[model samples]
Target chain A: MSRPALAVSALRPRTAPGWRTGLLDSLDAVGAVVLSPVELVGMAVVLLGRMAEFMLLAPFARDRFAFQRLIFARDLGDLLFGPALRVLAICVVLGIAVALVIEQFATGLLSQTGTANLVIVTSLQQIPPFVASGVLAARGALPLAVRLAEMVDRGQIDSMAIMGVDLVMLHAVPRALAVSLASVVHAVLAMVVFGVTTVLSLAGLGLVSTGTFLTALKLLPVYEKISLIGLQLLTASILVVAVALVEGIQGHGEERVDLARVSMVCILKAATVVLLVNLSFALSRMPDLPVLVWR
Target chain B: MRPAAPVDEAAANGLSVEVRGLVVRRGRRRVLDGVSLQLAAGAFLRITGPAGCGKSTLLQTLAGVLDADQGSIRLGGRPAATALAAGQVAAVFQRDSLLPELTVLENLLLPLIAGQHLSRRLAMLRAQVLLAQFGLVDIMHAWPARLSDALRRRALLARVMAVQPQLLLLDDILAGLDSAGRALIGRLLSPPDGRVASIIATSSRVDDFAHEAELLLTLPEGRISPSEPGQEGSGCDTRP
Candidate 1:
């Protein structure tokens, strides 16, 4: 080995996870926090641009405006069965788990104090929506990513391009909108599913009365619900488009194994984006947050 | 901006293609290097090369798919990109380009419907006529994915013809065809009185297209050079 290489190799054997690496990693974490707003907004712009492309030029573009709505309705129907139902199951399961904790062990103390109110509100407002986002990222977005990737693999995307079909407008836009709208719909459905399950479980053991539950729930205003739904919708749309670009579009140019890896990475990244954004939105509304939400 | 003209009015104006020192790089390797050629309107230039010899790259560059790393390609006194944007070029790659969801007739109607306005009745009538002429009338309603490889290639060729593009590019799309199929394509490409410009890349031996092609160009070692049509003895082993 050369003299410099020999010296660096000798140094590496002695050093314990260098101080420079840790310091750089810490700096990166700080940068992420400071730059998150810019990052999120940039992601939003990209999502909007892709959706706009789909709206303007795909095969759907040739139709009349009324016909476009009919197509959008079809897209909505597809999402309800695909991503929304998958996410709904996740939300319901989460609600049951949280409700069980409250009912079985902390019945008296939780019912008497503010913790009961906090748990109830968090269950409906934050937890279900967050978990729903994660579920859609994995379940709802998976098939679209796989289909687009396969198209890319088989030269179908290039074929459309050759025919002057705007692929982004054709493929990306429809999926993005479907996922976003489905996310919002799923959030509402999840909250309903979660609320009903939690209330029934709490009532079954005589832990809480039905009247008390409904009154506590009315403490949160309409704006809180609107804000949470809006945030979830935005996050879902952004992650859906991001996954499509990563796993769907780029994956088309890759082999099956590589595409699978890309797809797994896409799902992980989408879930991460959803969790981080949901946490940020929750923190922003924490002080003025809604009261007992499972009524 | 000027008002739009009739689609066929502009399509009848032929386009010539010229490439000078064109170089295309995939990752780090240079697929095409300093390749230069000229083709007049109403001419057929057959490109013969071994596999992985950048035959597809040259055709893709000419069709404005992959951008050139160095040098330039001009189509009818304008840049290749400009000609492509003006709807002067059409390419049939080795892979199947049909949309699986659509019937063959619906997919064929895509290009024809893009720039021109047609009522559904008129569109169907015209599509019937074109498919009939291409000997594909029976399979008009069939799904593209269900067709055989040779038949799929013919459907793609039929789409290219429907567009009536000035510059046509075929990149080994004829590989799976039988002799009759090959002759049908050859005749379609070079009809008795047609003035369309075309550049085809094939691994078929020199003798296969000797009677049909007017100019023969061989891409050996990254650069394209001219060779005599059906020349028997000049022997360059080009089986890739």
Candidate 2:
């Protein structure tokens, strides 16, 4: 009736035993992690490079910044907050598991393989996809979900059908593609971070130095892995987003449809896409790197 | 008192709508159970019923918003489903469905733009004329939220008219209007010479509409009782 007073009132107290408050707290924690020195530096460097690229091209610089400003305002939250929040959650959980495993196996596993560092790096590789998916889910999925909710409430989606707008193209496909791009960025960022951090840390420790890690990074397997991950993330994002958008639009036909239902569909879609990507990546591991890349 | 005819006279052509066993379900409740009716061209049918009696649902189903469980509805000799699929119907609801943030002109522009016929210039000219005709020229730029309930209703009606619909489905457009305002809108809706076929769901039976209407289909519950000849002075049955 009166906009159902979103959990803002109950969120006043820190101790409020509500999901809304909990979500806020989790978001705040994510903000802290993303703003940490290393991430901030990475983000700033990326932003500066983009600006420099704009500046160097005298003809296109102004137009580029104008476009960037429009896109940045539109995508800031999904780009910055979505993935950062996702990374925070993943880092916390995975960080705990990795710590536990290291404590348990300690000297034995590390000493035996002489590749324990590789294992750690490989495990951390998941961060990018996680961030990308979060961005996709947030940027793309949130708006679609919100639109569906509004459609259900106001009956506009029904009106759309009455007017003969193609339900899928008019709303769904663009929504999916828009969200998927965010996921792609997230995954690429994660890969870059992984590559750079491994090189820097290995050099700092003097265990393998910068050139050694850089050489390892150049190995065919690493490129193959990153590329394959990109392909997989793209594929998965498109699929999940398509499904979620379709479902959200279809929900309007019902006598009554709720946001909870749309959200469940979103979660299910994200999970299915992630699993498919993981499976694809595992399968791609056996293929020859060059062949896979070209094909 | 017949008005002078327009040169085009296209707006005066009427369209017929037919429903065959139209059944609608809102959860367990079957709002319109095996409902069947036929509205001829150049005619007005006033649907009257008690509150919560599926009067609005029936109109909505015709408007293509609600899906019928079992049956078919046709508009202008084609399936209502096909007609809507082909983009050929417009409606005005009991509740003010105007976009509150937008001005009266913007609200009217939505249907025209959506229908993809009139250009911006043509739409502006038509909107201005409609506003002036409806006496809404004073507040054409005012947001719907700022207008009074009656004014908002009038603005929405004006917008509905702007689309030049063949089948105009109105849901209680005259519900909250004062006598003078209601008479004016009813007159505009039913210009003696103009022939826009319509189905208006209303609680009150206005005296002015009595002469113009061809049929009166009364509904006590969800079912249409019987179509009787239009009678004068049998208006404003205000009993709740």
Candidate 3:
């Protein structure tokens, strides 16, 4: 099939000195996402392999020393402190704003007999994540895109390869994991911010009591709520990593190439992909997301 | 100068490289077609080819980074990929390929850290000695991005030596260096008292390697034929 051909093409032997064909070869696997199920599974396996490679390169692998873990923690801290802070703050702000507007306007017709409809209409578990993940991707992914693009623009990838180091393991793996962790962190931070904002804003306005507003959130479909949270994180990390890699690798040149220009494009493309994934997934999975989160 | 400490006896025994009917096809074009050659441990093989003759491919194949479409490559009777996976095979590309974010010392110590899992103290000690041997002590802490091309080149070669791979591959990295750089290439890439076997591919035309390279081969039209220093039959494809 075309997929096998693509995989073979990725393995094309001749590398003229100037061609950064390595990046193109990686793109081949990415292209296979559109292929048939068997090929798609194959592509998934490849992605998993790279993830494993990245994990092994991670400084915190089980075998590493305290020193290694300390260094790795510093890197994760840098990412968290830099771009991730914006993601968390933005998610919280969006959550609080949406909560304020929804609560203020929706005088739910909660006649004592309307409890079931209240459960369906007033579930805080579903829409907040969509908003939070979207905001997080928008506020996050760009800086990471720039950093990754610059790594490629420089010869860091080639250096890793020549060292017999797995490039994905060294670069991609930690990033995917860190950003995924950051996704959850954003979700939790949003929950806290929304909770606090709800108490302070409603108390200040003397509208609804904060205890009753929180009581409605208690009966969440626990499994679906957790799964949705995971799915959002997974999608966000994958989209950011994929777009960054594509943009970074496409620029297969050392001289006469503007790294800043390439990185700017990478940031734009990554943000676009992140938003598209958030929107498409939210839309396509809409039927199930609320049923699970609200039930 | 010798290795900082006594080299591992096992590490000192050089690796032999053997390729049989190696074929590497790129986009319906046979970049390397049915290539066959062999080199005994401690031997030197120099490949000179014009652009696009699969010089880098062949070196990469020996280094076990690139796959061979239809052939076999063995280092010391072990498969090339297996040897490479075990860190017994090493390569230096034409590009600096140093970790730009890392200091030269950290880059050189990486092989030990990644492969041998050497402790911090030992890895640092080994890296320093290797750097000193290569006359790179002064810039050991400099970022690779800040170093000059020639200086970075020396550091790259020294980094490979730090690995002490059985088979060390050079992909035309020795071109355009001043004499000091060339001498460093000779000292590090030559027999090294049988500590490593080296294959150098150069697109440049120069005499720096003439005296030291025991057997030279030229790649024209995807075929490997002997160059000067006559046939060191053991290092050539002497098939009928």
In candidate 2, what are the lDDT values of residues A97-200, reduced to their tens digit?
55455445654644333344454455445555655665466456556665655554545444433433222233443344445556666666655555555445
Ranking the candidates on DockQ from highest down gives 3, 1, 2
Of the pair 1 and 3, which is ahead by TM-score?
A: 1
TM-score of chain B of each: 0.81, 0.81, 0.82
Tens digits of lDDT, candidate 1, A3-104 = 000000000112235687678767867997687556656655777876676567655545322223443566668777766566667766776787788887
Query: Please, what is the whole-model Cα lDDT of each candidate in the order they appear?
Result: 0.62, 0.56, 0.57
TM-score of each model, paired residue for residue: 0.76, 0.61, 0.66
Clashes per model (N, Cα, C within 3 A): 3, 0, 2
lDDT of 1 by residue, B149-171 (tens): 76777788888777667777777
Task: Name the runs in model 3 displaced over 4 angstroms.
Answer: A1-9, A12-33, A36-71, A88-124, A127-164, A194-295, B1-13, B18-22, B33-40, B69-74, B77-86, B119-122, B175-180, B190-195, B205-212, B218-240
Clash pairs detected, candidate 2? none
Report interface Cα RMSD per prediction: 19.1, 14.0, 9.0
Indicate the worst ten consecutive residues by lDDT in candidate 2 chain A.
A1-10
Instruction: Summarize candidate 3's per-residue lDDT along A1-295 as a digit string, tens digits.
Output: 0000100102423455444676776676677544533542443355556666545655455433322343346545755555545645654565456546645564353323223223332334444455455554544445445555555444444444545554433454455556666666666665566556655564455545555555545544434557766786677665665555554444332232366776676566556656665666556545654563444
**Runs of candidate 1 exceeding 4 Å displacement:** A1-44, A50-74, A112-118, A150-159, A222-224, A251-257, A289-295, B1-13, B112-128, B135-141, B178-184, B187-199, B204-212, B221-240
Best by DockQ: 3
